[model samples]
Target chain A: MDIFNGIASGFEVVFQPNNLLYCLIGVVIGMLIGVLPGLGTVATISVLLPITFGLPPETAIIMIAGIFYGAQYGGTITSVLLRLPGEASAVVTTFDGYQMARRGRAGAALGIAAIGSFIGGTLAIVGLSLLAPVVAAFALDFGPPEYAVLALAGILLVSSFGSGSAWKCIVSATIGLLMASVGRDLFTGVDRFTLDSPQLADGIDFAALVMGLFGLGEVLYDLERRIKGNSAPTPKVKNAWITGTDWVQSRMAIARGTLIGFILGVLPGGGATLSSMVSYAAEKRAAKDPSRFGKGAIEGVAGPESANNAAATSSFIPLLTLGIPANATMAIIYGALLLQGIAPGPQLISEHPDVFWGVIDSMWIGNILLLIMSIPLVRLFIKILQVRASIMAPITVMIILIGAYSVRNSIFDLWIVIAFGLLGFLMKKFGFEPGPLVLAFVLGNLLETSFRQSLQLLDGSLFGFFARPISGTLLVLMIAVPFLVMAVRLFLRKRVAQTDLQKEYENA
Target chain B: MGVPTRRSQDTATQSEEVGVVEADVDDEAVTPAGAWSHLVAGGVPLAFGVVMMLGSINLGLGSPTSPQPGLWPFALSVLLIALSIGLLVGRGRFGPCESFGSGTLTVIAGVGSIAAFTILLPLIGFEIPAIVLAAFWLKILGQESWRVVAMVPILCTAAFHLLFVEGLGVAIPHLFSF
Candidate 1:
């Protein structure tokens, strides 16, 4: 009943003309960019961030939030129609959706994606509304040790999950931390790694690093493939419309995905990419026709689409309640909040209910708007997908260059983008996963700073990490979960191999 | 098309051709070989991390009231070196086979475009360099007709200038500013 009142208040804020307009605009832009390969939320958000400086912080936050989730919905379009996923989470969608498309069921695939995203996003918001208050209350009792443990657990899980190779993930995360170290030491007048460059004193901007790694690097990878003739025109779409049976098949898939996504989204370091993967695996396991899964099952499209949207929505809880950013995008949102001079903590809800409630209300509104807008535009989006690499390749690269230059009006940033672009290309060539590197880069500074701060609280000892029960439990979970997964995988593989050998021996 | 390898049946045939074109110097380490190249990549970061740890020991570690300078970096670097060693021992058992195809044109165009942009940025300013870079890149990538060349630059520069400069308020260094 109390939560219902909060929801009512949230609706009142979201219903305002300005907030509603911004939400609509955000979703439209999110869809457009998401439809375009090599253009993601990070680039769009970063480019548009400076403009939000003039608007009401609440409105700006609402609009940006709209773009974030809207993009998730939009990303499914290309994945289903063209087998090209605009975002990482949508990668799983391409498996089944593209197969469906080849089977001339593009319409059904698109419909399932849209409907699933709406269901998932809405349910996750409900989870946020109900669960955030409880979680915030629980987090209120946390001290430095608990915070330390949470940060470490976040880094360990994020880096490990981000990088397919555990060692690579660790190294990339470490590199992120080192890059964060390039400023004037807060306590001493001594500079650590500035190398006498005055600009280095302030340290590297996370935006610049993100742009370098994701934005520029991605375009360069595209360029190399195109030039090598490996990126010829992909299969084009004739239609992207859904049929009646799609809704019936997708209802349970959407519901299940939303639930799975909500739980994962609530956990620190659990996000859209991971949720989508798990949802895909779950759907496959539960499907009566498991063999049809990778061959264009409608449930596959519905499940992951729902999961990603739900995960995207739930990621906001930690930021609003505890001032903890579980990922880079949320961290940037935190930065934007800081610029508004709004300190996110226990007092935030009571003190700034409008900002909090307005955002919550707008997320629901944004999801509706995106679903309505994207459904009709599915064919149009597919048409844009037909835009050849020749046209997109140059334009994407130029945008990268200009984005790098515009950040500080410095040419040096352009060089940084170029350097990172080449590095990204080489990494792609060698099968080095770039997602972990980017995620680690984003979380690198926060992890190191918090870890060190916790140590200092305990007079430089690891015991502090284990002193807090929550921290200790989280650490134990972090160490245990990966090993358990590994062991399970090994056991399953061994069993299968043994069975195969036995069959062969008997036949011989 | 040459005869697709047996390995091509399970894997995407596209990347396989690129792989065959490359000299397989360490073929044994290539397939299911592990993370040798990953281990090699870890070396630079590990060394960087070791330096930071040593540097932090020389500096004061900040406490609760006052944050220390080297504290975060030092600890992170130590983590880096540890991870690097872990990667070497755990992942360095194998390497990826390099591609041997002639991607020289792509490499040149891709790398050249950036170099040109950097050199041109301070001289001709953002608009011209961006347009030129866009045109050149598109051309090199095989969209060389005048329509593509003309339309792409005009649209790209106009849209970029509008979104970034006018809309976002990111100041563009004008041609004469340099």
Candidate 2:
């Protein structure tokens, strides 16, 4: 009865006339961001963050969360239709999705992806509902050092998730960590790298950095390929509906992917990428013909798509229950919470059960709403994509400028966005991935505070980082994992080279 | 185990070629226009972080009880520098201009317009400056139609003003007409 009471209360809060409108607006913007090739959910959330400065904390957060998940639904559309992933998690889906499109199964592929996402999302909501309170209770005991270690561990783990060349990942992560240091020293008050520019006194805005890196950077990269006159051939989309056989084949993959994704998502620092990769591998291993995986197998598309959505849903457990964000995107959401004055630790559930439960409850409503909106609009979105970037570019630039200016009504911030946009374009050209940079920027403030607090608590002895069990264990793992990955990569490389040599010898 | 193997196999044929092509692409992406000036494009955050770091010197940015003021900015600056270095080096290693023509113009145009808009925004208020900025940017970027140029700035300015100011109660600073 009380649970029912709680649900009713949640509905009352979320379905408020204004809140409902905000939720609808949030999803629409989220879908637009996800459908666009360069923009992602993080950028959209950050850009809109300042606008939420006046709303109720709960309403603002619910709407933002709605945007985050809504984008997940829209991300698949681009990956399937254009072979261009709007979000990182959708990268894997593109493999099978584009293939299926090529084979005239775009409808079936789109159908399964949508249905699977809904199922996974609904399941994750149920899981979160059951687990949040218990997890929150446990997280109450954590302190500053624990938080510091958690953030550090997240950065390390995320770096490892980068594709290709562990060294590149390491270097990229290190650069991110270093870029995090660009502003005033939180400990000493000494400017380390500002070089006398008055504009940098506040340090880098995570919003501007992400907007530049992802949005501007991608534009530059795309321009390069486009100017070469290699226009993307618009594939003729076939019946975008799911058939009975398609459903029968995809049911198992979706189920398995959802389960796998939710579990992996519970871990820190790995969400869409980890879940999709794991699901892809699982689907391939279980497939009758594994080769079909890269060639448009329904299982391939369904499993990874389901896994990505499920993982995106489950990533909330750590945030809601433990007050921890395992990656950059979640870190931004955490920032949103902080702005709302809603501290997300162990006490959140009992202290603010309505907020927690309402948000959780809203996820279901939001997903269902997204399903209703997205299915009918899939074709419309596909048509929207056909609007040449050249045409859309101007509109986007206007939106970015207006969005930037509206935040704090500050011209300074708009200028900042513009400057960062250029930086982003350049960075993309240079092969530096912006993901780690944005992640670093988000973690920058926390890492500094946490490190300094730990130092202060331990009287400046570095040993304190290792003295705490949780911190110590995590640090050791962070140190060990990199070396292990490096060694393994080297060993494999050596082995491969030896095999090639042996083959040459045999030919001789 | 298989992931790495499969990845390597996928890239095996093209890894070396990819490296070479990537270097050429990098150069194309950043040529006479794309060079270190591109680094200045990042000057906002770099400068912002520096100013914040400097302010912490005396402001007691972080308290001794929790965290000192200088702690966050210092860390942020270091991260910014490392990232910048990585970007610079990564670009340098790759080179430019084998494929795309003077792509750095996009970077320059984007950064220039944004900076110019910021300077003009406070002077003219939201609508005129925003419209001019948007129209100028659109025209420069190749959208020539008056409708394409005119509609975006006017509509966006109104939409933003309504959403942020009227609807949301966000304070919007208008230079001239309310």
**Candidate 2 CAPRI level:** incorrect
lDDT of 1: 0.67
lDDT tens digits, residue span A1-508, model 2: 5556666777887887877777787777777667754445766676566656567877787888888888888888877876666676777787789898888888778888888888888888878777766677666777778778877776666666543223334444555565566667665666655657755655655555555555555554554343221024446654457888989888999999999889878766557666776777778878887777768899888888888888888888888887767665676777667657777767777777767877888888888888876676677656444333443454456556665665546666666676666655555444444555666556656766777777788786778879988778878987886665457445534422334322222111
lDDT of 2 by residue, B84-168 (tens): 4554455434223122355446546655666776676666666676677667755665434465565556666676666655666
| Off by more than 4 A, model 2 | A1-9, A163-240, A479-508, B1-101, B143-147, B161-178
Deviation of model 2 at A254, angstroms: 0.8
Q: After superposition, how far is residue A242 of candidate 2 from its true place, in Å?
A: 2.2
Q: Which stretches of candidate 1 lie over 4 Å from their true place?
A: A1-9, A12-18, A40-56, A227-245, A268-270, A288-296, A331-355, A426-449, A484-508, B1-39, B50-68, B91-101, B104-108, B142-144, B163-169, B175-178
lDDT of each: 0.67, 0.64
RMSD of each: 7.8, 9.4
lDDT of 2 at A136: 74
lDDT per residue for candidate 1 within B25-63, as digits (tens), equals 211222322345554465655676688888776665665
Backbone clash pairs for candidate 1 read A107-A241, A107-A242, B21-B100, B22-B99, B22-B100, B62-B68
Question: Where's the lowest-lDDT run of ten residues in candidate 1 chain B?
Answer: B1-10
